[model samples]
Each structure stands twice: as C-alpha cells, then as structure tokens.
Target: MMTIVVSVLFARSTRSTFPSDGSTSSLITHYLAGAAIASGVIVTPPAVLALTTYVLAPSLRHLFERLLLYPLFGAAALVFLFLAVTTWKPGPGTPTSNMDTAASLVNAAAASALATSGIIVTTTGILASNFWLTLYFDARRCHPYDHIVLFLLGTAAHIRRERHRWHDDNQVTIWRASLEVVAVQVERDAPLSGRTGLAEGSAYMELRQEARRIAAVIRSHKRDLAEAYSAHDVDAVVASLVVGLRAFCVGDRTALLAHAPAEVAPRVGRFARTALRLIPATVLIVAGILLPLVPSIAHSELASNLRWYLIVMGTITFITTREDLATKIGEAVAKVLLK
Candidate 1:
C-alpha cells in the first residue's frame, strides 16, 4: 500500500499536467509526509525488528541457557547504547542572530517535545518487549507473530509516549497526590487511636479531627504545604499531635494505612483521565504530520502544537485535581468497607 501510494505520487509529480509554480513544493511536502506516515503506521522498521527480537529471545534462553546468554545480552545492550548516542542531537550551534535565536528556541522546544514522545514510546516498547521477552523465555520457542506483536505494541507505545509528552510540552507542573504524607500524619495519631472504643473515645475522634484539619490545610495552602512536604518538613509541623507512626501500623488497628483517607482515590482517577486525553492527541498529531492537511503548514509545526497541547493538559491535570476530596471518600470505602 505504501509503495502504491508513493508510486502514484511520484507518477503524478512527473506529469506536466500539474502546475509548475509552488505546486512542486506542495507535492514534495505531501510525498514526504505520506512517506513518513507510511513508514510510521505500516512499514516501521523498529516495530518489526523489535517484534522479531522478542520472538527469538525466548528460544535463545532454551538453546544457550543463562550462562551463554549473558554475552548476547551485553552485546545487545551495547548496541542499544550506541543507537541512543548516535541519535542524541546536541544543542544548535549557539543561536547568534535574532532569527537564529528564534529558530533555535523553536527547535529546542520541538526536540524536547519529541524526546518526551520518544520516551513514552520507549516506555511502552519496554513494557511490551519485556512482556514478550518473558513469554519467549518461558515458552522456549520462537513465534513470528509474538515478535511482530511486540514490535507493534512497542512502536505504537513509543509514538504514543512521544505524542503524550508533546501534548504536555510546556509549563511543567510539579504536584503529587499528597496522600502518602497524609498517611504519615494519620499514623501519628495512633497512640490515642486505640482510645476511641473506651470512655476516652474523644481522643480517637480528635485523631479524625486532626485528619480533617490537615486536609483543610492541604486545601487552603497547597503550594505552601507542597513545598513543606517536598522539603520533608511536613512531619515536623504535626509532630506534636502525631505519636509514633510505627505504633499505628504495627499493633494499632487505627493506623492510617489501614484507614487512610478515601480521598486519594479521585486524585489517582484524575491522573488516569489526563492519560486518557493524551492518547488521542498523539494519534491526531502523528496523523496530521502524515497527511499534510495544508501546504503552508510544516510537519514540525504539527509536532510543535502537539508539545504545547501536552503542556496544557499536564498543567490542567495537575492543578484541577489538587486537594481533591472525592478520593478521600473512595479511599475510606476501599480501606474500611472493601477490606
């Protein structure tokens, strides 16, 4: 199919019937874009090769055993390292002029975005390759389909990764679900936690109250709290109220981990939503690069847009989900009811 398309395009390019002005540039752009799409979507070499490697890796284990496999693994690792070093593009020859500076900035931004996409692609490939590698070693057989599927999954995963990172190219946000630290605080209340069932039940309620208080602080001053937690000073602030965290986790059933806030669940869920948005955006940008929808637009521009989109999505995902309360309820259910 790719050959047919290329042949048809090249055939058209040769005909005198097409206009001779900027039409040639447009045609060239289309041909190149289409070729890229053809390779990426259909005839991608890495995907095919990786698939083959995955299929055979298992058989190697059976034939050579672990002792003989070590050198082959090392050699393969070295080759991968070489490929990485070969592809590593150093920064542009220090942009001297204003136009050079501008172009350099654009390129820098583009490279970062593409690299992120590449990482994601690599991650997925790594996951798929590792899975198939395990399967091959486990089965002690070579299957072309298994290898091919690995390649497909890996390549697509790579592109998807790049596309994801591209969409989140700008204004990186540093945020966390902030649940783990909160769990520590909950643990601190453990000494008095055991008192809840007896006449001193008010102290147990106080621990729950403390949870609310900490939760409120998180909601009102997230940036400040985040900064504090980042510095590892969060535990210090509530040191007075929190008993030994270990006490709760050990003998105390009232420990935070066993009964941590159900609210962290929504935050986890939000991150999932952000990932959901990332998938289609990547597909769109890659598709656009291949299609060449407008003659004026460059494939690089489409790539650039993808980076910006990712940045926006990441920023939004990080911010909007901050101090999310829905997770608290869900966490409560999972810990108490589900358990």
Candidate 2:
C-alpha cells in the first residue's frame, strides 16, 4: 500500500514540477536535477524495506506498538518548540552547537525515514499474509479515490496560481518589502485598492512596479537593522522590532494584511531579529524532534508536541501570510489588548 502511494506521489510530483527547461537558467536546471536525484535516492531504501518486510512477516499478536519509549519522541519535540519560540539573541555554543545539532538532525531524519519504510512494508505484509496475496503483485486501498483527490487538489492549485499570478507576485514583493513600510504604517496601515481602472497588462505592470517601489525600503531597512545591532542600542532594537513587525502586517496575497490579533502574530523585529530569534528557535524546535530519537535522550512526548506546534504555526502562517497592513495592525492591536 505504501509502495503504491509513494510511487504515485513521485510520479505526480515529477510530472507536475519538472517542466521543460528550454529557457530556464542552468542553475535552475541543476537545482531541479539535484532535487530529482535526492528524491529518488531517498525513496530507494524504503521501497526495498516495504517489499521485503511485508513479504516475509505473516502474523503478529499486535499490529502496532505503543510503548512508553514512544512518548519520549513527544518530549524532544516540546523542548525544541520552546527553544524555537523563545530564541532571540545569539551567543556562544550557538554556532558549534548548531553545527552538531544539524548533523544529528540529518542522521535522525534518515533513520526515521528508514523506520517508516520498514513499517509500511510490515503492514502490507500482514495484510497480504492474512488475506492471501501473491509476491510480485500487491493490492492497495482506494487507489482511484486517492488519485481523484490528488487530481482535484492539483487542478485547484493550478487554477489559483494562474488566477493570482500578479496577485502572488504582489504578495511576494510585499513580504520582501515589509521593512520598508514599518515607519510609514506605524500610524496607519495602507489601504486596499479596488481594481484600478486599467487594462490587464497595464495593471500587472503596475503591480510589478509597486513591488519595485518597495525595494529601496527593503534595502534601507536592512541597513538600519545592521546599524542598530552594531550600536547595540535599545532604541534601535525597538525601532527594528517596530519595522520588522510591521512587515508581518503588510499584505495578504492581495495587498491586505492579517487583521485578526497581534497575539496571533507577534512580529519578529528584523532580519537581524529573525536570525537572532526565529532561526535558533527553528533549530531547537527541529532538534527537539531529531535529538530524542537517538541514543542520547530520545523522548516520544517531545515529538508529539513538536508535531502539534508545527501544525498550529503552519496553519497560522498560511492564513495570515497574505493579509494586508491594516488587517495586521488590527490583529496586532487585538494581540496587545488580549495579552
């Protein structure tokens, strides 16, 4: 079952992603090549495990194991989440520790993939052994329905990208330009414009132009962040925070910011803030998941918490990513009051 699903996904991903690179840069081509190679390389062992394990195993008293050791995974995840949530400044052991952490993460991830592959293989084996199935041929659940869901989802995504190409560009630019708008919008967030009474191409060109307009702001913010951090001034730090947070509230896909609540979106201060904060936190959060599985201090509880945190933050970021400035401010205000 897992074999079939993975194969289908690979095939679909390949078909959808690797378009002809007649006009693309060599860098893009190389990147895609690397990606394709990595995916195939990663899938090979799991494919082998699923084929062998399921074929050999016949019966077991229990299908799945839920031991105390599993919760260990959850604990690791929670610790990492806390680190990721709170990381703000840089310090010693931060660099070398980070290196060691990354390497361990890679090893753990590889092992995890191997374990999952083996499980899928075992599950299929049990099902086949109990139901009576051949070795070469395998049966799976709802191949058609799964494919249908994939198709529908893919089609919808395609339509959306096409419909909002300009809008998407606008969004990408707006996010990139968040630092630029900080000072301007501290008093009032930008207003959303209705469709400009212009031709389609003209509108898109103007959209791109607006994106260009924010470029200087982005650069200026970057410089300001550097200067503030170098000076180690609280005022600069606060100013940087103000500017960076302002970006999160800048725009949704259509030049609209998230207007829900500030607690909902505690904006990081700047790229410096992000580096000092988000990255370390992300590393810890990831480490929390990756570390506990190893021989040292693996905990299942941490892993479970990490998974939930990812889901929660993933949903929040996805929803607010495209909101405009006013909405973000409104939400930010909401956050301040709520807290």
Candidate 3:
C-alpha cells in the first residue's frame, strides 16, 4: 500500500508532457493495476515486475507511448523508494549509534547500485518489449530523450555528497540554549505548573508571561545586545540578506543608482560605456540571428571568415573591457562628486 501510494504521488508530481494532456495519470493507474494483477499470477514471480506490467496491461495495447512510459515510471518509483530508504536517519534514541557512519556509507553504495540497475532494467524492458522502433520517432512528442537526460543528471547529483552549512541548522539550538539560560528567571517569575489537573493551561500561561518578560529585558538592553553581537556576525547576517535583495533588484536602474530622474546624462554615459564594452559579442549574436534570413550572405566565404573574426574580437573585447571598466568607473565617480 505504501509503495503504491508513493509511486502514484511521484508519478503525479513528475513533469511529463502527457500530464498536460491527461494521459499520464490514466497510464500510471492502469500500469500499477496491471503490475498488481501480474504479481498474483506468477507462482515464482518474474525478475522484473515493471517488465511484466508493461507486457500485461491491455490498456497499453493501442498506446505505444504509454507502453514505453509505464516501465520508465515504474523504474523511477523504485529508484525513489531506494533513495528514501537509504537516506533515512533513525531518531536520536535509536540504537546502533557506533555503526551509524558505516551504515550510511553502505546504504549509499547500495542505493547507487540499485539506481544504476533500475536504469538498465528500464532500457532493457523497453527494448525487449519491441517498442523501441515504434517509440523512436513517434515518442518525439513526449520528449523521452530529454527525460532520460534529466534522469541521468538527477542520478549523478544523487551520487555526490550533499553540501551543508552551519546556517542550515534552523537556529533550533540557539533558541533552546536561550531558554535554558533564562530558565531560572522564568521559574522565579511564574510557577512551572499548576496544582491539580490544570497543569497544561497553567504551563501555557506561564510560558506567555515568561516570553513577555524576556522581550522586555531584551528591549531594555538593546544597546548592550547590539554591542554583544560581534561585527563579523552582524556583517555576515546583513550580507546574507543583501545578497537576496540584490538579486531581486538586479537590472532596476532606479533602485540601484538611488538618484533622481533628472540625472539623464550620467545614465546615458553609463549606457554608452556598457554598450562599448559589449559591442563585439553583441555584434556576433546579432549577426548569428540575422544570417539565416539571407541565404546568399549566409553561404558566402565572408560568412565563414566572420566566425573566426568574431571569436578573436570577442576575446580581445572581453580582456580589454574587464581591465578598462575599473578605471572608467573611478573616473565617473570623480566626475559625479566634483560636479
């Protein structure tokens, strides 16, 4: 039941062209039903249930595209299940603490093996089912090759170690530590629990009161609190926030310059500087876009020569502009201030 639910959910969430046309949902439902029926039929069970399901599903009789897709979807579900199991971590109270690292390594290796096998099985099942030729050109509508490339990319990413940072801790430890430090003050101000059966409600009231007291204390020591937070830590936090805001405000000249609309001359100067720097690459890109319209010009020997010329000019422009921009920016800043 868990397997079926997870497979259905994954199939639904995946990006497929058929989903927009409402065929993917039907295909997945029928495929899983077929797999379940086949599982009951074979006394010993086949080596690949996905292959069996693809072969047995009568709904897939006329739908050659579904015949190819169902097996791939099944294989993907198996891979996702394997990954989930392998990466799952036990709670803090769970046993096997000493072997946790070793166990993780083993699980990762096994999951990689399973993923590779799943891909192989999917490919083999498609070929053995004799749907490859039918799917080759006809399946272009579904972009199967793009999906395969994406799957390979996902698998590659999964095999790599995940990157984590201290900032990713969600600040839980910091909150816990703060509570612990103020526990004595909290107890002095309010009872930890009420008498009789009113413990839950009383505890909630005490927590609210304690939070108010903590907030007041923080407000009173705002200056000291500011000083206590190191310059580096404050800068790091500010920098992180600025990075996100900067990305959002990118290309918004008014937000970036913070000057009045009357400053048209400086804006024009900036534009001229930028356009001069980008001329080589911009010309090449424009030529590439326009060349196809004129067959005579496109086929001329000059056209072939321009490709190498563009490359050389682009390289020189990049190097010179990179070096020139810093000097030009300084001069612009001086001119603005002196004005």
Candidate 4:
C-alpha cells in the first residue's frame, strides 16, 4: 500500500515532464519489460534445479545426500550464472534501433531472460526444492497490480496531455523559462559563496533570504499572475514573478522586484473540494489509529479488521485524489505559510 501511494505520487509529479504523445507507450513498454523480468526471475530457480539434478543425478547422488549443503551449492551456482548473464552489457555501438529488428529482439529477449533469472535466484532461492511456490504466489498477490496501476497512470497522463496540449505546452514553457532563470542565478552566485554545501554558511542563508523575498513578491502579485494565466497574456514581469515562485518552491533564492494588482480572490475552492474527499480519509485514519486505545474494542477482531479496512480505504482515496488540484492547494498553503 505504501509502495502504491509512492508510485502514484511519483507518476503524478513527473507526468508533466514526459513528452505528451510518447509518454504512455514508453511507460507501458517499460512496465511490461519489468514484469517480464520478474516472471523470468520467478521461474529460473526451479528450472536450474531440475536441470542439474536430472543431468547429474547418478554422479551427484553422494552430494545430494547432504540436502541443505547441496541445495546451498546449487543456489550459489545459480547466483553466479545469473550475475554473469544479467551484467553482460553489449558494446556501445550495438544496434538497438528498429532498423536492426532481429538484433534488437534478440538483445531484448536475452536481457529480459537474464533479469528474470537473476531476480528469481536472488529472492526465491536457486534450489528448485525451496519455498519457490510460496514466494511466487506471494509475489503474484501485489506485483502485477502495482505495474497495472502504473500503466494506467501513464495512460491517464497521456490522455490528459493530449486533451490539454496547448495549456500544457504553455505551462511547460513557463516552467522551462523559470528553470533557466534559476540555473543562471545558481551558476552566477554559486562560485561567489565558494562553499558547495547545500546547508552551510553565508551562501545558503543568502539563498534562503532571497527565496523568502521571492515568495513575498509572488504573494503580492497573485492577482496579476492569475490574470496573466487566465488571459494568456503573461508579460515579462509576470513571468519573472512566476519564476520567483518556482524558484522558491525548489528552495532557491535570488532578489527580484515586480509590480502587480492589489486584491486577489481566495483560490481555496479547489482545496475545499479536495478537503471534502480527504476529510473522511483523515477521519478514518484517525479512527484506525485510536481503535487500539479504546478498551472495549482494542482486542476485538472486528476492530482490527475495521482498522485495516480504514487504512486501505484511506490509501485508495489518497491515490485517487486529483493530483493537479492538490498540488495547487499545497503551493497556495506553502505561499501563505511562508509569508
């Protein structure tokens, strides 16, 4: 459940960075590759054990008498083999493009096989007689579902990108420009500080101060920023202010001055919507945590199951929440608190 939550968070955070059209297919292919590799690893130990035992049965009868020692040796051999195959990278100029179809396919297949074998040997043990079946079943319970969720997340991102191509492009441009400004400032100021530490000395303090100033500037210019975004007329001043906000978000600092409108309306409506969903989940989590503290329900099976159910439901709610709106709310809160 934690893994799923983290993955969903990561997918949403980075989705905007992926190329609009190709992101989904690229992500799906990667997940498929991972699944294939996992499957291969799951099956390799049994295959190795069967091969070695059957092929050398008569000769290895004496060794097989010491069951634990023999299996350990077999496992060691599988480990060595798995390592060799998986780490055998081809030459730099290897033809991996579509034009070299056969070579690509063969290379991909070999890599997948080696990865799968390596994983199986590493996790489930190389000996066929180990708890291979138990491990495989356990893996099946959660692994595939995680990959499927990742795939679906990628697909959703792709659909969103396509649907809002122009808007996304504009946002991307804004952020890119913001990043460029930040990079320039870092490059210019980093050397003056002389120290390279992220959390030390005058440079770091200066950066923090600058960040606070930038955050203040952004807060003051909220109305203008909103107008620019809505009207699609982002001027240099607004762009700079947005960059300042972005820089502040990423813990960067540089001083800049800007002017803008006076009064900004509350943008908490989105946060309210998100809170409507999150409130129940938060309550559920609180209830779950407090269940054990209650004398009457502490030892009850129903209480334990209810706690688990609430946690699961809360996690699901978190994953399904609208990431964009949540991110905006978070940014708004950050700005307010920083002020």
What's the TM-score of every candidate structure?
0.22, 0.20, 0.18, 0.25
Residue 159's C-alpha lDDT in candidate 1?
29
Q: lDDT for each of the candidates?
A: 0.38, 0.37, 0.40, 0.44
lDDT, candidate 3, residue 44? 22
Q: Residue-wise lDDT of candidate 3 within 1-339, one digit each (tens)?
A: 344544533443331223233444454554454344333332122324434433443222233445445555455445545544444333565566434443343333333344343444445555545665664655455431233223223322321211122233333233222322232222322232323234577666644454344323322222322343443443443333243234223423233223222212111223345456778667755665566447887777566555544444454554565657645654554354433
Stretches > 4 Å off in candidate 3: 1-69, 72-74, 77-86, 105-118, 121-132, 135-339
Candidate 1, residues 104-207, lDDT tens digits: the string is 33333333333333333444445556766896685456431233223323333332333323223231111122223233233333334434655677776665
Q: Which prediction has more favorable TM-score, 2 or 3? A: 2
Worst 10 residues of 3 by lDDT: 259-268
**lDDT: which candidate is best?**
4
Model 2's TM-score against the true structure: 0.20
Q: In candidate 4, what are the lDDT values of residues 301-327, reduced to their tens digit?
A: 566666665565565556567667655
In candidate 2, what are the lDDT values of residues 1-339, reduced to their tens digit?
456535533433332222233323433444455344444444454454444433332111011122111222333233323322332232444576454443333333333333343333445445545544432232243221222223223322332343333334443343223333332232121211223433566775544344333332333443443333232332443343433333433433232122212122223333333245445446545654565566534454444454444443434443343447435654664454433
Q: Count backbone overlaps in model 4.
A: 3
Which of the numbered candidates is closest to the native, going by highest TM-score?
Answer: 4
